[model samples]
Target: MNLLSLLRGEAFKRGIHPPQNKLTAERSIRRLPFASRLVVPLSQHIGKPARAVVRVGQEVVRGELIAEADGWLSVPHHAPATGFVEAIELRPSAKGPWEQSIVIKVQPGSTQEVQVAHPRDMGVLNPQEIIAAVQQTGMVGLGGAAFPSHAKMSVPKDAKVHTLVVNGCECEPYLTCDHRVMVEHADDLIEGIRHAMRATGAVRTVIGIEDNKMSAVEAIQAALMARHIPADQIAVQAVPTKYPQGAEKMLIMALFGVEVPSGGLPLAYGMVVLNVGTLAALGCLLPRGEGLVERVVTVTGPAVQRPGDYRVPIGTPMKFLLDYAGAPAESYQVILGGPMMGQAAASLDVPVTKGMSGLLVMRGADFCDRDDQKIYPCIKCGECVAACPMGLNPSLLGMLAAMRDYEPMGSQYHLGDCFECGSCSFVCPSSIPLVQQFRVAKQVLRERAVA
Candidate 1:
């Protein structure tokens, strides 16, 4: 039942691959000039919104906490650039709606000067103290989960986490932000993993990457070796190159040969997986005792003139980033993550946050060519069934969704478990938009529940 034993056996399973289109994998990350104004949404993560501390016209320095964590499940927000507060009100965010936000105007020619972070030895701190210190830094999953990092660290005392699985499997095509982070900031990642081990009391750690990125695997392996961390204590294993392999459950199954029971957390399998980027951010924040005000982001696609990864400050606008990346003015669609699972932006003014790992700009020519975006009936060819890693009948669900028979789909067919990986749509020859139908179905059910 122990997870370590599972890794010794067969690892991860199936998912479809889209074009990697990774135009910036080899490019070094650069820092963009602070936008003239930042619209930092208070609720960037999945939990409670942080409370704003600074008022309008108040001056704030880089890394200064502008909003304090409102609860254990939230993270604080800091000034990414030295600036004066312009307003604290509802603003457009990347999530497709306006949320309460703090806006700032960068002081003319502001330079990067981080506020003095009060640091201390990790050995001197207790587990709770370490958790408190982590909360102070405003860290989140950074891999797009955007769950508060402190909340993740606070596992129930009754549930013991044995293996801290570091997911280096950036399997989503076109998203090399995690890959670049691992290659460039391996030291920080190692240090952060250690902090995570301490936080969770895990006896061992393993960094799992898909085979496509041998360079990242080599880099992390070398970092571990130099640190004198034994091979068995901290490892670097190459998982198969499969889409959704980066999905926490799929990665666990692949790297450790352990299946996370349907709808179960890895803790049930005695494992806790953290993104490589999460560890890297922790490595930077834990020692300095600062907040997560900025993060590394990938801005790439055919529509972009300058396609590469850049360190974007939290609260920068989507429009600014697209322009900064030299995106074509006539681009057709802009996605906030990878094509398979990324959300479409409703407006260009929405600001970036901890959860946005990739921004993809696709022109009309880049996507599948279609006149009128036609929808064809599924021929029941069983392709989707074979393609589904979870082995669900997506054709039936797609039909149900189209017919507005959502209740039967939920009650009789188990619709809630779909994570919307877009696998079925990828395999469907008719291009029935199976994933799109599922999205609408889930949304309708969710809204009905709330209503």
Candidate 2:
């Protein structure tokens, strides 16, 4: 980065600052007890579903590969516990659909330790080898997108990556898993950054943390000092605390003062951004030669009794997690992530996937009186326009969405640029579900294209 970039503070325009209800920010991550039956979804990521390799009734050890990647776009699945495969059939997903899943009944004395036969020397692995190792780990973006990590590292042959932008900005309200990872797993995170740098062939890395996480910044700085890496190679920079500041484009702009071209990727501009949690986990897992079978999830919200960060094994049922967290049996809505951009869970039967960062449970009364409950007509207010970080007219897009003019929303209005961060909906005085409309419109457009 140039002197001008350094002088330009990490500030992005037009983002709403909702209450930072980060209940577990100070809480250390504790491991949850294994649920009786774990439901491993084959399609836990954004790509093709994994092909199951284990038969029903087969015994599997923890971290053992249970499924193989179906194609280049897919990721494999690992057993989250030492258990017997109970069944392989359709199971309820948080998205309101039944998906092919492997049901594992936990063994009587299943241990938390993974069965690793050998540890690999990461120092000897080349870039391609590192990427292949990432694929073997079945790693994905733990930042909730769940895009395969290996795929991100597999930059195009023509692209030349200069910097590996590390996203430590846990800007979403009530989600502190990434924050805790940065603070508690600093060594692993630095190691992960090194792996990412090697994989992406980037000479330097910049960790853009939100100002709210000063402790995380300090922790990363200490780690870097202990590692003896030059500041030019990797440095931690604090960005302003703002909603949607954690978005890739927003963080990129905040750090480098460069806006990714509309409908283009950061890779196009010689950068590869990876989430702190994803890299930390990769750093820890790659050496062990283990697959991603567990992750740290923030179980918090107004409705949770034992609110804190919990190291949860993947495929643990929502009901089991909630029960462990002392959630009420009465009617309460569960959002699988933060309140801003997270979606409401369709059912409690959904098993925790690689994408889940936090489980936010709230009673209906929590939002009963909020303006969002009752939809109102757009008042032609420019609140959304001012709040949108992408500089798109959300009011116009919302109007277009209501009219089902989806094509123009993309073609003329640049709907594809909107990352759906929910700032527009938060600031809309009329309580219009502008973000929800955009989501539906985008989904409809995808379906239309397929048709």
Candidate 3:
């Protein structure tokens, strides 16, 4: 370890060290049984919504494609279980809107065996072929950004990628899915890294894990040794455990000591970063030519009775997950990721999508005592200034948002760079929801632009 880096707190400036409530980190991942009904949304990814291929009453087997990609930026969706399409209608989504969805009713006694497509030897596949195969898997960034994996891997011709940064830093509190994936699926992750490296023309791979997760680091290093991959080609480094360190820019900064330019991507730095869970899913699916139907999710909180990492199918309802996890009977609040940045679910009926990493349930005092409902006046204390990773003046931004001065927030204050990490809100002593105000301000600006 570099003494200077250690002294500078792992060298990435301005981040908080929240209590890592990683309850499920030590637990082995357990597969949840198929739900009786699944509501598969067509627009799970960030691009255009998928076109439904299977109509109502159409029988589909597990892993069979029920929807096709709408465009180059979209991804297909597969049946999570052998079932008949019950309906194709609008359903509530976690995003607080009605979205087109395909509802399926599982067949009685139907074995949920996934019917694999054309399996190929990944070693022989070229870069384009690997990318095409990855698109077929319906993989997305499982680290809460549901951007299509294939799109992310498809580097532009103008840009040259030199490094593939594998993010194994599950920095969010109470989320252990990525940690478990790193610990148990290290080999698969390595294979996926190789594929990603090929797809992006990256010559070397680096897995950045939080120092707190020594087990995952050890597991990945051992896997690399077993595969005889050279350290020069692939290396695992432990970064400081800090909130939002798993963010691509932050991770890249911590690992390489370079800052990605504001309003830019890792591609600009000749690098591509991938989440550990996303790559592991690719490693498991690409070789078998299978679609992503399930993912490992951390179901934990103070209200959960059976807290653990679970292999949950896509489109599994939050209600089913809560029931299985033995959520408290009383009214509870459920968020779809970590406490810091996760969105609170508007309805339990919404199905788990590709971006969801954890199902956090808080009850009683933990739920009702939250300061979310309280909005205090900004004291201009400058805590948000210190907490902001992007070095933006969130206090000024918050003040501008209060005055409905949306345009200035973007034009002068660099509002687009916020990324809504919730750090400002977390550190705000006045309980002002700075991130939320920024979100509204940005939305207003977008609407204005359209007008």
- Candidate models: Cα lDDT each: 0.83, 0.90, 0.88
Write the residue-wise lDDT of candidate 3 on 314-424 in tens digits.
999888988988876248888889988888888887898888999899874763356466778888889999988999999999999999978889999899998888888
Clash totals for all candidate models? 5, 0, 0
The residue-by-residue lDDT of candidate 1 on 41-98, one tens digit each, is 8998888999999999999988888999997888888998888999999887776677
lDDT of 2 by residue, 346-371 (tens): 99978999999998888777654674
Query: Model 2: runs farther than 4 Å from truth?
Result: 1-8, 368-372
Arranged by lDDT with the best first, the candidates are 2, 3, 1
Supply the global lDDT for candidate 3.
0.88
Extract clashing residue pairs from model 3. Answer: none
Q: Top model by TM-score, which number? A: 2
Worst 10 residues of 2 by lDDT: 1-10
Output the worst ten-in-a-row residue range by lDDT, candidate 1.
Answer: 2-11
TM-score of each: 0.96, 0.97, 0.95
Clashing pairs in 2: none
